[model samples]
Target chain A: MHPPRDGRGPADPPAERRVGLILFWLYVLLYGGFMALVLVRPDLLSVRPFGGVNLAIAYGMGLIASAFLLAVVYMVLRSGR
Target chain B: MLHETSATAVAIFAAFVLGVLWLSFFLGRKGQSASGYYAAHGQIHWFVNGIAFAGDYLSAASFLGICGMIAFTGYDGFLYSIGFLAGWIVALFVIAEPIKALGKFTFADALDARFQSRGIKLAVAISTLVVSIFYLIPQMVGAGSLIKPLLGLPHEVGVILVGVTVTLIVVTAGMVSTTWVQFIKGSLLVFFCGVLTILILGRGLAENTGSLAPQTLTVRPDGTRLVDGKPQERGHDLRPVGTIRALPERYGSRRETGALGPLAYLATLEDSRIVTWAAKKRVDAEGTHTVFTPTERSGADLLKPGGSFKGLTTGNLADRLDFASLMLALFCGTASLPHILIRYYTVKDGEAARRSTVVGIAAIGMFYVLTLYLGLGAMTSGALDPTDTNMAAPLLAKTFSNTLFAIISAIAFTTVLGTVSGLIMAGSGAVAHDLVENVLGIPMTDHEKVRCGKIAAVALGIVAMALGILFRNFNVSFLVGWAFNIAASANLPALVMLLFWPRTTKQGIIAAVTVGMVASLAWILLSADTFEKVYGLSREASVVPFSQPGLVTIPLGFFVLMVVSLLTARPAEHRA
Candidate 1:
């Protein structure tokens, strides 16, 4: 489908909107990837990335952290522009 | 047993109610105009609006339900927080700026702004009410559970009290008081949860298994409760459980671990052996008896997925699909919530909306991170009530200090107040602005509109109280998942299509919303969870294949809107 003239769709809208979309998908990948692993292969999340930190814990904390990180990043990008 | 009412708790709770009522009355002075009453005159400071956004968004479901779920089920419950927060991405990227630019009072205002179609208003308004009611049920339920332990009141009384209080707030001051209420509750909730987590880290982990006692609670139909075949006397209730029954070999013979860092705390929990309760309720000859049995689980096991979402582990294909569907709904539902959407109009411009959303994301994200600690803390704190999972967080606070318990419980009650007020505000807006005024063409003065809204708030408040009392037994988070599914299905499709698709017609929006809302609602009622839980029937006999309706109904909404919009496409009407 083609992009409508409304601001909802643009390959590169502005710096901040672009950053929001990019970070949105990035955060989604981290979250969705973790969820996909849980659905498709439950055992994979059991692997310990390091001592005391398993893939599941890492992925879950990563999702929460990534959200905050992305939001701050968007603010910085918006202010810088 | 989660009941141990302190005079301190009662006094604090009373003070919170008085303060909130006072604020509402004070703000009521400025809310005489339609703009001031509904949209706060579009003058809320961006920072305060941002925190109010956090307060409004983090309902009882977030603070209580997610924490309780994680405390009970482990890592899987945190997924709700992730899905919930991630949905804000859609808001930030697409909906935030545009929504602020479009709507004046409610979510329907944005949808019908361009079309000027009564069909759009009618359909979206009805969707708003449906989603609001679904959302309100869990908040009201959370309120009911909270007061039972703190105030020693019955569950229905708590629900009624909250409904009456919230209705007063909304009817008196509208969004101004609601915004301030949410802002205060939101800040206090995050602050106290942080303090509680710090206390958990300071206290460290210990093997406290000597107090594990399996208890049975029986509740008669007439509201009499019995513990272990004896009536629960005043001020003495059932024991709050959830302790580390045994330790894993890795932490052998180490009764306590010293203060650990954030990562170390989770790491220590992973290799530990914790005892979680498995409850079975049987309604039989005399009364309904729920037996609480202590089951031990390895930390590694608890730290894994599949505890709450059965589809992740040993379930069949349909079960796994149900898990994915619920997650999909949560991810989409955040942007679609009527209460969350209307907050945008409370701000001034698109930039303020964008900034407020970012602030909200940061604040909400930080609180969710604390939830992992709080849930884990409650799981190990030996303060869990096996019968009521909603009490995990507040009861966990009780483990630290009676003062903390009072503060947390009061703040949690305020959490319910803020959220219910927001939901009632959105519903009243739909009733007065969209349905009565727009669809019926009952032209009224601004004062009459505000009066109509107050009446609607009282009526909806009564409905909320009734449902909250009816669904007192449900997990607030689980009930919230249903609301998310409905909102995502009913509202998201029309919204995304309207924003992106040029050929979308007013009729298509109406058909899509009506079909999406009804189909998803029907699917949920016919789903396995409803069959077993609501209808008291066999899950095997349920008609629907999956428990969650989002995977099917959400896609169906978009497809219906696309097909109808294409068939009914008209040129040069709404070109962008």
Candidate 2:
């Protein structure tokens, strides 16, 4: 059978350990920030009685943050490789 | 139930299913080999795999459950969407490369890659099956739930239909067919939901003044009490029907009160109206069982977030911490789900796995955003079924047009199909690859392994059908939360530590998996929610302090792994 294309083998040291740690911390930061937003501005998470649920905007903010984190991780890992 | 079946909707659904099966069958020729059947020969294209990721990830819970929750509960439901999408970050950055580089078929393959210990394999494999089975229950339940309203058939029949169809698909084409089927379902689900959302926006909110007010019923000394002319008593709920009373204008601050036009209704909530229920006393020859009547809430009390978490706001720091812990479990749980992890194997390589995850996240994220609209729409449309939350979105479509309702219901059926196939595939793989091959020390060739897996697939399908029937009354999405808890607890610690922590020993991995799985399962069985919902017993009888097990089981897993690894440190050193 052909050797796996990715250079790292099963026995090789994990190449993305640092990246994984960075991502983990970034996740913690984003989660904390969102929770803080909810605590400080409960309105952001609340349903607007007349209009549509305003929480969509908050979820939108989350989506953007996740995308940004994903881009950064991709760049770091690709460059490292 | 009023409208006759639309040929176009039926045709669309049938064509969608058949088209997917055809593509899977055609491309699945390559999968005739053993590895191909199990893992697509690990050579799938990145883009195809990416779309397939959407197929595998967006299960019945995401489509029907989250939307239904949002329809009924407001922002709390959207939390599920956030948690689910957040998990991909873990998958992409932490798991994608390592998992692809390490394992061949099942998750156990990866966990036991460095340490070929039978103990590790046994622990991981059992965890895989447990998680997969728990996940399967919801999907099967969803299948039965959708079939009843969609085809107007019995629930058990729907479960059997899905079981047989999914089994045929898996046993014949395996992962290749399963992946394509998911891709099609994913694409259609996103497309239709987007279209539906646009339709909702275009129509806007409108006052249903012309429509008759929903009938309200009450229990009295005589028979059932009727407020107006219509049959008002809907199940165990009583009182006036509450709806979105008004909408906000140009800015979020300005509230417009009145009967909202169809489009404007999207933004309106009835400040003076609330939906609540009163307990009913049922008298029989044997005894009297309490019944309930759905009611509407009017006043300031309806404005607050209520339900299960009410105690948390007042309790000690631990109660507050428990809420955060539940959220954490949900966020991390998606990446750790066995059904999801197995999808990585369906693709060609690490790159494919990563790209697929990106696509899955995008599709899933967009759908979640639309769920806000769908839920809000249902809430105002007066289509809220107090009895069945799972039917919220489809019923919202029904209020708009019978044609839309038919189409949405068919798509919901496909959602069940897509998710159930993936769960069954994962379960079968665990049985064939991990339990039979690795744990049992079966001396079988690769071809023989594939054959055994197909048989296992059939067996799992049967079990799923039975469980689906047994758990028909439970909410499909609520059932899914238990699966997420078990998966996150049992799998995440071992998988993450093995990939990142060099000091992680074989024994540590095995112990962590065993402890995590058992702890979460036991905690769930003993929790208040299970007591009330599953056992039909009093919540006070529950031994567990909190209903959600993630707060306890997750940290417990990490703690067990660390302590065990330290004690077993000599194993690794001695090997070195």
Give per-model CA RMSD: 2.5, 5.3
User: In candidate 1, which residue ranges exceed 4 Å CA deviation?
Assistant: A1-19, B211-213, B220-224, B234-237, B248-252, B571-576
Clashes of 2: 35
* Per-candidate DockQ vs. reference: 0.44, 0.23
Docking category for candidate 1? Answer: acceptable
Candidate 2, residues B68-124: lDDT per residue as tens digits? 776666545666667777777778767776787788888888878777788988888
**Model 1: per-residue lDDT, tens digit, B1-576?**
647689999999999999999999998998889998899999998889989988998999998999899989898888888888888888887788767876889999888766788999999999999999999999999999999999999899999999999999999989999999999988988888899999999888888866567788998888788988889775556777778766556677788887878888888888788988888889987889998888889998998988888767885799899989999999899999999999998888877887899888888888988988999999998888888899999999988888889999999999999999999999999999999999999999999999999999999999999999999989999999999999999999998787667687788899889999999999999998999989999999999999899999999999999889878876554444
TM-score of 1: 0.95
Considering only chain B, report the TM-score of each candidate against the true chain B.
Answer: 0.97, 0.87
